[model samples]
Structures are given as C-alpha cells and as structure tokens.
Target: MIKYAVHILFLILVGICWTPAEAQFVNLQIRVEPELSAEVQQELDFGTQITNSGRSQIGLGDVNMGIFSIRAYYTQNVYLNLTFPDALIHSNPAIDQEIPMELSISYNNSGLNRPSESTPLPSEGGLVAIHENTTNLTSTSDIWKEMYIYVYGYIDIGNIPNGEYTGDIVLTVDYD
Candidate 1:
C-alpha cells in the first residue's frame, strides 16, 4: 500500500514538472506590382465652327480629335468602354438650346500616329483584345505595354442657336 502511494505521488510530480513545447514561426513575403493606367494625352477640341443651314460633319480624319494612352502588363488583354453624351449644351445659361452630337472611337495597338489606319470601335462601345503586335514594351523587368486611342465627334447643326457648346466623354478600362 505505501509503495503504491509513492508511485502515484512520483507520477503526479513528473506531470507537474513537465514543460510546454516551444513554438516555431516562419517569415512570409510578397512583391506587389503596379496597376494598369490610362491617360488623356490630348483633349478633344472641335475648335470654332460656323453653323450652316444643314448638318455639319466632322470626319474621323479631322484635326480636332482626342488622343488617349493606356498602359498595362505586357501581352495582357484589357477592355475599354466609352460613354458619350447625347448632345452638347450651349455655354450661355440663358440659352436653352442644344445640338445633337455623335461620337466614335478607334484604337491602334501599335501606337501609330495614324488614326485613320486604326480599327474603328462601335459607337456604342465594345471589348477590344490587345493584339500581340500592338504591345509597346515600356519596361524590361516589370514588363508593361502601351496602346493609343482616338476619339472623333460629329454634330448636327440645323439652324440652331450658335454658341459655345460642350459635353463630357467617359472612358472606362479594366483587365480581362
């Protein structure tokens, strides 16, 4: 009986003396890259035009056009969407007149200066897959590609009130 009690006390002491195991940790790391970017290199300007009795048109080849540049990962596909205004309102607050306008866009993945040579996007806007040849590598380590966008506008001037008119154009871009 005494031997058994001593064995139990010895086991209790051994359990109380035991220490917890050590904990281990590891270091984790990651590298974040830059996001895609777009910028308006040139503003769309119609300049000064005298309204005639009939409809006045501005072709895609017109001098008054907008230029935009987009940059993204090399060989990565991106989508572009454009929201166009229905009309251009007169600058005068008192003038309650507006001219009906239409807008069109074109793109060149090759970054060519020729807007006419580029592919014409729908007036309603749609997705454009960046061609492999259109990529202009901006960096080597963190590879980046660039493309150009051209915008044109046309207005119907049917003996409407002549004054400075303006509208907004919104362009949205995202990775595919």
Candidate 2:
C-alpha cells in the first residue's frame, strides 16, 4: 500500500510540472513561368509557265513572260530577293547554241507597292519589304497577301535572229 501511494504521488508531480504551449503558423508563396516564341518560315512559287510559241516578224518592245508568288509565316515583316542568272536566251537549233537576251522584272500584288499595280525590279537585286504578320495567313482563302513577280523580256526583233527562247526567274523569301 505504501509503494502504490508513492507511485500516485510521482504521477501527480509529473502532471503539475507539464505545461501547454501555443502553436504558430507559417505562410508560403509560389510562382511559375512559360515560354513565348515564334518560328519563322517562308514559301515561294511561280505562276503558270509562259511559252511564246510561233511568231512572225515582230516589232521592238518589252514582252510579258510570267508571274511569281511568295508566302511568309510567323513574322511581323518579310523580305524578298531575286537573282537572274541570265536573261531569256534564244537557242539556235541549226547551230545548237544559246545567246543571252535583255530581260527585266516587274511585280504586282507586292505589299511594298500599291495594289493591282506593277513595280519594276532593280538590277542590283533589291530587297522588297512586306508588312503584316503572317500569323493570320493560314490558308489560300485566308487574308493572305501574295507577292507577285512578273518577268519581262526586252527584244529588238529587227536586230536579233529568231529561235526558241528560255529563261529563269529565281525568288528568295525570308522573315525580316
């Protein structure tokens, strides 16, 4: 009975010494980031191939050759450059040879110029600017702005010999 009383007294002492403590709170903040970028792309194409078939004695002047087109994407601006290796060349079948002829280039549907009009291309491969981002240019029916290139062959029929003539118009496109 005395041991039991001692054990009870020890328990009472431990309970009296123990004390309750207050709890605290901690606040935290977090954040996240994302990537914002666009990929640039371009496409260039030529219209129908032009062939001036048979002809009689003609006068001297510029002859319309063909048309070209350019499509750019994912950019607010674009640039176009053209390089002509050689003008329209006339090949003499009898002699099996070719001669370079004087050629010039003009454009319609160019964003750099007035619409529905023609602008001559400079000889030094001038850079043509195109406004309006291509993000909205999704399809052919979409409000797509086309850059039309026109090829013209200058000829003096009186001074040159008659034969089959050929030429190439190269167009390069890029995001500005």
Candidate 3:
C-alpha cells in the first residue's frame, strides 16, 4: 500500500517536532530580635508596725505600701527606677547607735508623675523616679502594666532610742 503510507507519514512528522521543558528559581531568609524581662508581682507592705507614740514629730502618714506590682517583659520603651539605700538603718545593737529614717514615694500610675530623676533619701532612704517612659511602656502585647506603690515616713522620735527597723528597696527596668 505504497510502503504502508510512506511509513505512516514518517511517524507523523516525528510527533509534530516535539519540544517543551524549562523553568526554575529559588531564595529565602529570616531574622528577628527584641525581648526583655522583669518580675516582682507584688511585695512592699509597710503597714501595722509604726510605734513612735512619744511623738516629737514623727509622721507615718500615707504608709499604704501595698500593691507594688511590677511584672514586665519589655522589648522597648522603658525607664523605671527606684533605688534607695542611703539610709534606713536602725541598728542600735545596745547603744551602737544607727537610727536614721526618711522615705517618701508616691504613685498612682497611668496618671504618671514620679520620675524627676529622684532626689531625697539621705536622711534615711531616697531615690524615687518611679517611671519616665510616660506611658510608652511597650512590652510587646503581653498586656501588663501596673504601678501603685506609696510609702511615706519621717521620724525624729526625740533623740532616737527605739528599736526594730529594717529596709530594702530596689526596682530597676532599663531601655529608654
């Protein structure tokens, strides 16, 4: 039959001159950083113990040192410092003499007013610049902000000879 139709039209012109295949590409990278921390949930109660009835000018007013909460996890925007240890010693160890006391700190946070760089603690204890970030806390959406600590005391107990007195206050959070 004419050599089988010329070998089936030469295999259909070699399958219509076949040709098709080519394409490729690639790329990838990643980097991230930002995290800080702080903790002191709640502890700073200066209550109940205040006995200087002899009164020669001993004002123990405001003394509601409760709810001194501070549970931060910041990444940025921070400036909270409260360091005092210049004087809060009351060691008389049988006339060894060491009675000095004076500390005043105020706060109601969110209303923000304490960070004046703090000055006045020499008489006993001082340094109260509670917060200076001015509400720009920025803890990266962990949803945490609370500052409600108030402690005020000034004693002159007429020649100082009483007893029992201890102190410790150190709260610092950097990055401003």
Candidate 4:
C-alpha cells in the first residue's frame, strides 16, 4: 500500500543521515540528585544530610538513612554509639499502630577499649530499630530507595537518669 511505501522511504532517509550505531553517538550521560534530611523526634530534631553527589546514578544501593556517627564528649569521658535504626517504620496515614516492617542490624564489638583486651564482646547485640521518627525524605522516585545511601543514625544516653551530659554527633559517607 502507499502507506507501507512511505514508511520504507522514511527509514531509508534516516539510515542515510545517521552513521552506524556503534560510532553514532558519544558522551551518553546519566545523573542522580541526592537530598538528605532526618525525622524530627520529640524534644530533639536530629537529622542527616544525604548527597547523591555529582555525575553519578545507580540502579540501586542500600542507604543508611539518618546520622552515620555520634560522638559525645564529656568530662567523665562518657561514650556512646549512635546506632542505625532497623527497618523502615512503615505506617499508613489512616492507621496508627498497624504497620509493616522487616529490617535489622547486628555487629560485633571486640571490646577494643573495654574490659579486658582478651575478652571479645561475645557478639553483644545492637539494633537498628525504629522510633517515632519522620523526615523530609519525600520522594516520587523508586530509584532513590535502591540507589541511595540511607542515613540511619541516632544519639546515645537517650535513656539515663538526670545528669549534666554533653555530646556532638558526627556523620560521614563512604563509597565503594
């Protein structure tokens, strides 16, 4: 038909104009823009800044959302490890207690400076559990969850008796 002939002609014209596929194009670019912030907790607004960085885009990567490190300097030389929260605190806006989540973090502290040097912490457990937390991390893209570094972090001595305490949080990023 006339339509078929016209389609063939168009293809021929395009082929004449474009070079072979292998050498046709150069400088293909992909990009990812990262934004990081943290959920404001009660009486505390601890947060993390996520930077996707320049000239980078991944199909996916695990991001530890929130602060990465927490350092508390005190007179008595108190110390605490601000661990990452485990699992996404999934909740429906319509429901309160009904939620779905499956996430956890565990590490071994060989007591580098605790107790006896010979005694390992014996897999003394740690958790990345959820809290009543929320953040400005509202995204319309699924790529972020897969390709972003989650900034999961928190402060220490969060549950202690009345005492004068001081600490400063430190968060860092590493790429492989």
TM-scores for the candidates: 0.68, 0.41, 0.26, 0.18
Q: What TM-score number comes out for model 2?
A: 0.41
**Model 4 over residues 1-176: C-alpha lDDT tens digits?**
99999999999999899885565557888874533222221122323312221121111112322212211111111122333233222143332221111222222122121112121111222222121122343454321221111222333322223323233333222221
Tens digits of per-residue lDDT for model 1 on 33-115? 66677888888776676676445555666776888988776666777778977988888889877778887788887645677
lDDT of 2 at 7: 98
The 10-residue segment of model 2 with minimum total lDDT is 34-43
lDDT of each: 0.75, 0.47, 0.44, 0.27
Candidate 1 residue pairs that clash: 109-134
Cα error of candidate 2 at position 8, Å: 47
In candidate 2, which residue ranges exceed 4 Å CA deviation?
1-64, 74-79, 85-100, 109-116, 132-144, 158-163, 174-176
Q: Which of the predicted structures, 2 or 4, would earn the higher lDDT when compared with the native?
A: 2
Question: lDDT-based ranking, best first?
Answer: 1, 2, 3, 4
Put down candidate 3 lDDT per residue, 1-176, tens digits, no spaces: 99999889988887777667577776766653333444443445443344454322222222233234433332234454566564445655465444355555544444232433222333333333333343554565534444444444543333445576556766554544
